[model samples]
Target: MGDMITTSEQQIPLAKRIRAHIELADPITWISPAMICICGALASGTATGFQWWNGAHWGLILLGALMTGPLGTGFSQSINDYYDREIDAINDPTRPIPAGLVSLNGARANWFFLGFATFLVSLIFKDAMITALAVFGIILSVLYSMPPIKFKKNYLLGPPAVGIGYVTVSWMVGHIIFAPITWQSITVAMINGGLTAGMLVLNDIKSVEGDRQHGLKSLAVAIGVQPALLVAYTIINLCEILFLVLAVMWGNYWVAAFIAFAVIAPIYSQIKLYNDASHKNFMRYLIATNPFVALIQIVSAFLVGGYFG
Candidate 1:
């Protein structure tokens, strides 16, 4: 037992533990939710005609970003890594947990700490609605990864769960920081959720092998890869087109024009992905095209907030 403990300590050396903890939190995945949170703030600030130049206002916006990004998202990712460690062992052995860089107990502690921090920070906003939304976000994040109700096990439920958590909830939190959420904000946020769901469909492709082994019905595992790609790209493109139509109908021709232009590259990449449908191609497509997806969301937020205001 003493030798085993020594080996374990050697596996996760003390000096490298901080970096391992960060890796377990998966900071790279925080970008989308963080940016969307900021977009929510922008939309609310615009719609409410709030003073955008106020330093306090900007500070609040940054705080919301922190909740969604590092605190909330960090909680989500850490918990997910804990629950999905078995899957990760098969799919990505290099991950901190599977790589033995972080012990399972350490991972559990990390997520619990993050979840508690997220809750505490939400209270700092001093709004019941914001606090409620924050609680809901935490619950959703837990449901997405934890047992029995692990939403990620069901192809139909999983992607949308993530979308709502990562995009819609984050947006709502940001919006509520500055103003009450309106129908327009809710609608646009849900639209972004749909877009995220579509992207997540493609994301499942990389994990198909492990998903199949674990009986997780991810889109790529349930449907053939090529067909899943088609479905994903269709959902993505349709969401964009819907947003474009909404912009035009709202008489935001500049936004519409920008959306139209922004979509071309992604569409081109989609065609390439559709033809090949390999994991490498999927990564390339996401890296090359997802920026436009983000740009569209930001532009759509401005359109909705400006016109509706």
Candidate 2:
């Protein structure tokens, strides 16, 4: 049986191998960071009065989106899967590694390739700040999953690491690609980071069983699920309220009104989840609420770019 399994692993066809590599990258998860990148670019461009129709402006936007979405995020997810293969065996045996679709060596090679590609692409912009941010993102990605500093093992560290990597860095990279970093952009990015951190806490709820089995101290495991849900709800609501305040302060009443209206459903979803606090309910909450979160980020970007610029 062992020999047959090894033989099948070794004989995976080239097309299937390629598909496994893409699965390791988890392209669906790339959309959020990519959309954030687009928001950043749009915000910066609007603020700076950049010619929207100009090819160069669009090119920069495209490059930024590619770097954050595919290369940077791909590296993060691949490394995470490699390190979490054992946990995945419990939580989701069908993942590329545990399912034997991708060999361990293949996963390592994919992450290294994506990380190197991210670095090389960052240099193409010829901006020192961009290069530095790329390097920071790469290091954070490595630390988030790798041993000795596996952030995912600590409830305090894991979610923030993901939030900073996914939201803060992506937003800053997009903004910096077009304009110098500004207080407004940084502030909004951090608020989004807080939002992401909150969402990540909820994300852990779905994997609580595997996480507890593996002794990984995820938020849901560290604290009871109900308490963790409250923490997540608090963090999320606070960030949204802060953003609404900022929109009002920036005199973007349209953005403020939009936030006020959009927050209603998510708040209700949070209440529903708080009542049940089960993994099944959490999944439903995510589906019901995440789109509104994305819309808030998009509108907030416009608010900062239009008013702060």
* Local error of candidate 1 at residue 179 (angstroms): 0.9
Estimate the overall C-alpha local distance difference test score of candidate 1: 0.84
Q: Considering only N, C-alpha and C atoms within 3 Å, which residue pairs clash in candidate 2?
A: none
TM-score of 2: 0.94
Question: Each model's TM-score?
Answer: 0.94, 0.94
Q: What is the C-alpha lDDT of each candidate?
A: 0.84, 0.86
Which lDDT tens digits does candidate 2 get at residues 36-62? Answer: 887776667563733477898888888
Candidate that would win on TM-score:
2
Off by over 4 Å in 1: 1-11, 47-50, 307-309
Residue 142 lDDT in model 2? 91
Pairs that clash in candidate 1: none
Which lDDT tens digits does candidate 1 get at residues 1-309? Answer: 011111363555677988888888899988989899888877775536335778888888888888899989999999998888888889999888877788777888899998899889999999998888778888999999998899999989999999999999998988888888888889889999999999999889888999999888898888788899988988888888888888888888878787777667677677888898777778889987688898888887777668443
Number of the predicted model whose lDDT against the real structure is largest:
2
